[model samples]
Target: MSLTPLNEDLGVLRFITAGSVDDGKSTLIGRLLYDSKSVLTDQLSALSRAKHKRTAGEDIDFSLLTDGLEAEREQGITIDVAYRYFATARRKFIIADTPGHEQYTRNMVTGASTAHAAIILVDATRVTEVDGQTELLAQTKRHSAIVKLLGLQHVIVAINKMDLIDFSEARFNAIRAAYLELAQRLGLQDVRFVPVSALKGDNIVFASEKMPWYQDEPLLDVLESLPVAEQDGELRFPVQLVARQDGSQADDFRGYMGRVESGAIRVGQSLRVLPSNRSATVAEIVGPSGLLDQAFAGQCVTVRLAEDVDVSRGDTFVSTESALQPSRKLGADVCWFDEEPLSPQRKYLLKQATSTVYVRVGSVDTVLDVTTLSHGTDKTTLAMNDIGAVQLSLQKPLAADTYDSHPATGSFVLIDEATHHTVAAGMIRTLAA
Candidate 1:
């Protein structure tokens, strides 16, 4: 059997799979790829060889498809994000398989940040504690909170390994009810629950006859029908490069190159450069095929201005009416990843789009408890994998917006000056207010 290409009109659906360690995230992804016939002949042969290393049963171990690292295969756990691409007759998909361990919470956030939806796996057998107590897993709750905070509207909670439990509807309902309560508290939208067994291929790619109880469509069906978020806002173009393709002659044409972050831009549209506050009219729209009438969100195009303004990399061009405010102080939510613990004493480099500047932690307002969803008053420091609200003082004014308003200009990363390593991912909430 061969994989089929989707209709060109069918847009892509990007989603992420995340759950606690050993919850069958890898196996679920493997089942999707394998059953869809997206796996190549050579890859199937490799899976056959790897199956013996991890499985002793007759059924193929689908988890081998995503556990790419030797350490992960040896330890039997996911360590980093593994991206897989596939297509069906209905829709194309890009799936990011994220790690479930608490230490890798930062990795999960990175994987889910750009995802249009999230698939959270829950092993039915382990939904309860050893004492027969019904409780949600800490890591599971952490991932869910992060998913909501990232503004992902679609969520699927797949109750996997139902075959081992004899496909008990009561067990699935219990977990579903508990998770629904959590989803409500987190304000998640369009949450769905499905019962499945990745190993047995039940309720995955097609309906499972083993249960005969579930009437809803399988996981793949739900995924294909999920709606992607709409990009609705005014034009926001952050200049990445200023090119003079012909030569540096004053008369030679120069172009400001960047991707349109939102809205539409066309020739003769008025734009204001941020921080500099210089205004220019779009004189020409240049694309690979020559001239273009307009450019919209997600398109990369070069723009020429009516007048030669002193624009350079890191400057943002925005719609004259919907320009973002420039600020030196910001209140944001940050996920700290460094083991070095965040403190006000230390300073770091803030990188937002093409702009980079020095910044320091002004204050940490509160730290979130994943399980309880409670806030802890903390103003001094944050540890690894901690999600907290903090205020930042920037060395220079940054053109920014609230994440709820415009995500492209509302997010940033903090880099360690000494190691040049990314220490935090931040989402702005307010600018000096």
Candidate 2:
């Protein structure tokens, strides 16, 4: 397919780069930014003088662009999620350079949570060819599983370091076939494959002359062409705080402040306060600049209700006709982050958007085995980096949607009540009876 830049109306594309250790995830991002002229002069100068130059000769080590931490520089590996923002004439971009180590899977999850797409890099040199079959790295499977779980709109599996293997088409095809099998097992909807050498800049920003067999658009072109997933659904406005004025000149202004999570809210629109199920109307919409006739998803605004109907911080306002109802039981898929195994006996706090409630894991249904791409029902506990399905019993009813439908309201985090540390990132799969 020919390359086409996104129109200005398409908006920004938020994506993340992921793969196993030494798969060139950081290098790929660096190459994208460097070749696209997204890097500033000072940044380029710093790369030239970087103390840990992994590449030989005068070639710039592109990985240094995103590996900003001193530890990352010294170790030559990304430790935390490094985010970079740049714009092209065609589109604006936000790239999250996620760590590849299994130990840092939580960090990867944190980065992928808000991303619209993911680029998974597979090291061509690392793939083991066994009698006409290719074996992929375990981390590749894990990251792809997480992408499916997170419902990323698009996925690009870039076979990197192809230069090491003489840009062999046979090897590329073998790897692609293996990944396709895994993608099928994981039920990933949108996936594409590209052959690239991040270090050599082949098939990254431009098409690679070395690999003539690959006729598709380069990595950058594919990204620009990929549609930015729009947040579509009914109005979901979670009240973050209640804005009130007590002064005489303020005319008793009472506004519920929060970002519209999904859909749009307009003036005079009828809304229902969740949990309480009280009715109200949008009297006015206040934006950062001033009054706004309407507000859409991702915009932070204060909504003045036509009537005071017992709204407070953590309460949600939805379309009056919305089918969403308060429920105390929920079924969810979670990626455990803590070293401590999940204990159903213990109480944990579930924080979803503005609402926080005490919750208990009622049952550990199944745990995913990334190596086999299968779920094991015998597993009763989830260790760090393990993805599992669990049933939760909440102390109070919560208004939520399934993660696949509305991510902003459907996602949540589990916190250790004693340590106050986040333990697991969860996605609601079903609203239990």
Candidate 3:
């Protein structure tokens, strides 16, 4: 299998599924994998046995199929990231199945932070029926709201358990219009809705003939047709190393090495190294298969410059028009993943591109309100799984990209000074002009 690296490669799509309790997110995924013939016979047999046991004196449950944890199985809900991989001819997919309860909102964000798209599952009757689960529909909006804030433009709204409603097209369309309205208000585009019964395997992989009145592509078709996130931007490469591949006689060969973060890289082209604004002409581009005159997104290549200048790791190579300078201070939207709240005065080892520096937390602009999708002005501390915008003052100027411009160079992670644990993932908001 050809592994598409980050830089110019058409790589696998990572997506997540989130829903409220009993919304059938897991069953939807299991049915997708099973109906697509991605499951093993042994696993199917185990499920059969479990199914038999359940039917005889059983609950006829399917949540067992994906609730693969002891606690999750006991509670009958997902609690953490349960990753499953599969592929079709058009693309490969990684599914990060996340829990739906508000308590596991952090887990949902953890799953979604890297996802290219997301599927928010909901039950149809939960919206109309007066019950304790009305909050469930609200929670779906809250979750998708955060996903949009995190920059995900594509969202698939799956209103599942259509069999319970006798496959009413009106019921499905009602929920669909409601979600589309919410999505527009939240600034999310590419929202698609479909009604299905995950338990009965309707409209997941193959179109459900049961819902014949509805004429839309099935969920699998939608996923296959979706655009990949990697193809939406310009090329970026962050230098990870500098090495000398000696000629064995001259001993004076210098080359720049790094994984190409994006775009095509070519040999014999002039590149402007950033932060210093120095220029160099590429003499050769070396890959694992020897020297190639060109490399594209996702290639790890070493480039030899015609004239030797001072170049090192952490320097950025770019097309002349694309060069950007490093900044001594910047703002970031952080997802706090650790137990500790971010201390305003504490220093963290900020890792962005190839540079690491001691950065002080200047101030937290605001903590996002997950429920209302608004800002909490009085909030100063960011707790575990909280998303907030914060500013940082660096000890030295470092090359960076706005997360909106280039994800590779625009993103950074905070390391604990005492334990070295990664406490937060940050998206760079601005760089020096």
Candidate 4:
């Protein structure tokens, strides 16, 4: 529960939960926190009071733990992303319990963008409910693509609510087969399906007894055992800000501060400072270690260079030989979240990493019909929750990589030029390629 210190040796994991309502997304999280002994006494009392207000004969309704908004509590459904934090001895986790309804599909894209892993809840039933009218097939297609676009290849499919369906082995298998087929088409990696009754705490932290027909490594074991990417593959450090902490002949310290999005960096290593092709050697690494000569990826550290380079927020650092090309034009996959349709005539603020630039839609080359995940050619604009491929021209250049390569640098959010509210989430495919 304490803040992660620079020297704490803590590895943080961000996870997002997506599932239909009453499928036990909230209840499972509530149980994890309560059983893990992370909930406080006062919080439990609040839960007790909340339970008293519900109609008689209803379950404890653990969804109240995350349905914080009054409108959501009134509607009895999650309407936005509710973040919760809990920890074990091994690693600390930040959970994003997002809405399951099709209307709130944008929230799933928003939460999944920052998550390292995604837990998709599925109801185990004899028949798959494909609402032909609305909110069924289209919702699934949208969510599946969002997860893939967010660069989360480690997907854990929690096939929940076995109790309602009699915990039948056949039922679990049917649902698992369908979801696996979807995963395969998306080119997901390490995709797994675990059957459990989230409301009854079956096969979540441990194995379920009601379904002796099912046998697999417990869900918690799978979560803890998933592989994390290496510390340094290709270094991409986008400068957030620059600080001149001290200046003297003996110690002239000029530090470029930013979260290391990817890859490790070492002191005395040569780096190319972008926007001003000046190259220098890393002189010092300043962090909780308090001014060293090097640091690894995923840590927030200020890097000092041997030369006083004209670097600032929105700049990027990389190996001089392998520096990424910066550009003002880009090709992207955009998920529109605004009610108004996207127009090429209007411009919006494209916030990628620490850079903010105004970008106009040069061409919406194509949009997926969504229901089919098929490309619709000759597309000009998009409506709410619409997924499409867009070409853009920016007022200023940004340093970016493809989402598949480095998520931190490749993903961006579109800000309404007037309202300043984020209206869309986008993934850069390449630098104007």
Each model's lDDT comes to 0.88, 0.93, 0.79, 0.77
lDDT by residue for model 2 (227-339), tens: 88699889999899998788467489888899999999999999999988999988999999999999999999999988868988889999998999998999999999999
- What lDDT tens digits, residue by residue, belong to model 4 across residues 1-433? 1233334444677888886665567777776676667788888777777833343443455667777888877877788999999876657789999888877878878888778888887766423545522123445556677888777858888877788888878767767777777777776777888888766778877677787877676676566556666435677888988887566556656788998877778888898876566788898788976876566777899988888668888888988777587787889999999988898889999998898989999988888775676789877898888888999899876778887788778889999989877888999896852
RMSD of each: 2.8, 1.6, 4.7, 4.6
Candidates 1 and 3 compared: the better one by lDDT is 1
lDDT of 3 by residue, 135-182 (tens): 337568768876876677578888898999899887777777767767
Number of backbone collisions per candidate: 0, 0, 6, 1
The full ranking of all candidates by lDDT, starting with the best, is 2, 1, 3, 4
Q: C-alpha displacement of 333 in model 2, angstroms?
A: 0.6
How much is the lDDT of residue 261 in candidate 1? 85
TM-score of each: 0.95, 0.97, 0.87, 0.88
- Top candidate, metric TM-score: 2
Question: Which window of 10 residues has the lowest lDDT sum in candidate 2?
Answer: 1-10
| lDDT for position 91 in model 1 | 88
**lDDT string, candidate 1, 81-175, tens digits:** 99999998888899999999999989998998788999999999888754664678888889998998888879999999999999999898889
Clashing pairs in 4: 285-292
Best by lDDT: 2
Lowest lDDT 10-residue stretch of candidate 4: 1-10
